[model samples]
Target: MAYTGEVEVGGPPDVHELTDLIITKAAVGPMDNNAYVLRCRATDEQLLIDAAAEPHTLLEVIGADGIGAVVTTHRHRDHWQALAEVVAATGARTYAGRLDAPALPVPTDVPVDDGDTISFGRIRLTARHLVGHTPGSIVLVYDDPHGHPHVFTGDCLFPGGVGNTHDDPAAFTSLLTGVTAKLFDVLPDESWVYPGHGRDTTLGDERPHLAEWRERGW
Candidate 1:
């Protein structure tokens, strides 16, 4: 309900908040990776997802209130470019999918497994491990007060199509299958999708495109 001035770093982010979650999103690094700061309104505790580039600016956005933990979306370089610095500065607990844990610059404090639950404030996020994007690609989900769910899907799903499989058909199939079943089939049309890069979209906007994404074999 309360709006504040933009937390400008790369540029002013498109902010979104409903009920307990306040999302501060910004583009960072060479890839223009999206890094998000998710704050729990009641507890004032934060969980940072994909601590991409621009360490100083990311820390500046964090400001006085420190983060509770830093969750790496995947082992990709662009995603965690600033993970070490941000975690070192905030001393926030670091989490990565167990399979991708060893590849990170900083050792993961918590190696999350599929279906694992991450506790923060009064709610918990369920990790849906969707492989092929990486052996450990994950999407975090929890219900919002408005009835729609808020999903942080790293590079697995995007606006128009699924993430690049680097021409690997098997990976493309695996990721697409996982996304279709675990996300689209389960969540409501109103579910908000905050991806690892680019703009945000809702399930309602993307559901109709699934068949198209599949037909093209992207």
Candidate 2:
């Protein structure tokens, strides 16, 4: 409801109805990476997405009993710097792409693949592999009770920019192609996109911009 200063925490009405999916920003300025805490209301099953730099605050919001799993978006430390700390506090299982497994300090409980569905109570998180910034990058899709989908697009799709280029130029091309075909093409216009950085946008808003963006290149 009310945000004080350095910290802000609240769950909207719909969020509470399905799961305690709270979005928190880490930086003081524009480039803040977004992290989420999803807690199932009925079963109290909790999962975290990206740890960022504020694990202590993230822990305070989700607490101990609720968290069961954590799914990292990529291998970038900024998106997952405090993962080990939070995992230690909550004893939650960690899931990441197999390519990112070696970089993580803890062993991954689940190596996510494209099209894999992770369920908790009424919520279902579907993994869509989009490898541009990282070979194993993924965007998660969760459908609300009303059937409206919310995409947690890590570094893949930002408000106005896609993710940065990888070591291999082919990887970047593949990433953009996958996102355009798998994400932009398939998802409905009304679907919400919660990117890793900046504010939220919709498929409707992004669709028109895609042609121009593609011409200019990532």
Candidate 3:
């Protein structure tokens, strides 16, 4: 999709497959929040993550494709600024962790708890509740049958350290603890990290510096 200078829409209009899943990515809003479309090739059911901004572009990116659900990674306004618009346009059910669901502008059809499994077609994503950035912040883990795992961390685990803690020591500890235990310790080093904003990174690239991140403390 050609989005011109304002927004960069990367991925095929038809389908971009990774193993049995098809993924589409678009960077939207001034903040450049990533909006992802994940499809199960076997059934074509799709789940959209973070409809940050640019309703027209988001709706267009979704195109004629039917959306099974929309998940907002957290309660942050930047992440779901365009959520109401997208849901209105597509009629897709909305989901977020129970702790964070109350924060959204729209209603949630499903309150995703940690370890909750969301399945469509042959694709299954397990929700990992990683707190700190937000009380109910979640990371979706997809164990790709073909290769390594794929974890979509909203704003928790970035390429550098954990997501910004804004000098809140307690919050930082909460977020980093989740990242270290729930993510780093459990997931493989080869796990692909799809963040809420900016580019993607791998658990392998950010793991070795855990001690460094802890000592400095954001």
Candidate 4:
């Protein structure tokens, strides 16, 4: 089937194959959180983004290859519900934004900051920090040499608008500003966005609505 990037809880994952990487996205937990398993085609080394929930399902997806690292996108509880179990089972190293690391259930082996590079096998992801939903929310960017860049947006950027800021104007502004400068400005429109939940969208698809999101002040 085509890679639509749409997934449902308890259903099969949607797999998107790149030149050198294989991205398998699955929706887990009652909240329908999306967890991505990125496997490097060259080495078969895998890295999981957002353990979210359903350790058994995640473990099944991981299989016998085992995971090398797990990254928690932010400090939100829903994002890391299965962190402990996943880590305990796979013994994967944990990575999260420095500011949000301490709050996570598992100890962060690598406390990342903006511009930090996370490597697993031949694949490399650049961590970009965007504050708003949480103080240390981050999105991982993989600039594929064979194709357009792909981003794993935790709870930061979604299909329609930015993540929730709890109606705080300052927070909303900060998030919007970071998103604009770090993402929209730096990346190309064709960049594929894999959000933390719901369906996927392209940067081109959401760029025109920036002002509207600002005016709405979500």
Per residue, candidate 2 scores C-alpha lDDT tens digits across 1-218 of: 43211322332211323333443333311236667777765676778888765677677767656578889988887778778898888888888877776787778899988999887655679999887788788889986756567888988987675788744567667777888898888888888887776567788888888877666677
Off by over 4 Å in 2: 1-31, 166-169
lDDT (CA) per prediction: 0.85, 0.73, 0.85, 0.96
Per-residue alpha-carbon lDDT of candidate 4 for residues 102-198, written as tens digits (9 for 90 to 100): 9999899999999999999999999999899899999999999999999999999999999999989999999999999999999999999999999
Error of 1 at 180 (Å): 0.6
RMSD per model, one decimal: 2.5, 4.0, 3.4, 0.5
User: Residue 58 of model 2: what lDDT?
Assistant: 71
TM-score of each: 0.94, 0.85, 0.92, 0.99
Task: Output the number of the TM-score-best candidate.
Answer: 4
State the local distance difference test value for candidate 4.
0.96
Per-residue lDDT of candidate 3, residues 122-213 (tens digit): 89999999778888998999999999898889999888889988889999998888899988999899998888877778899999999899
Better of 1 and 3 by TM-score: 1
Shift of residue 61 alpha carbon in model 1, Å: 1.1
Off by over 4 Å in 4: none
Residue pairs with clashing backbones, model 3: none
Give the 10-residue window scoring lowest on summed lDDT in candidate 2: 5-14
Return the clash pairs for model 1, or none.
Answer: none
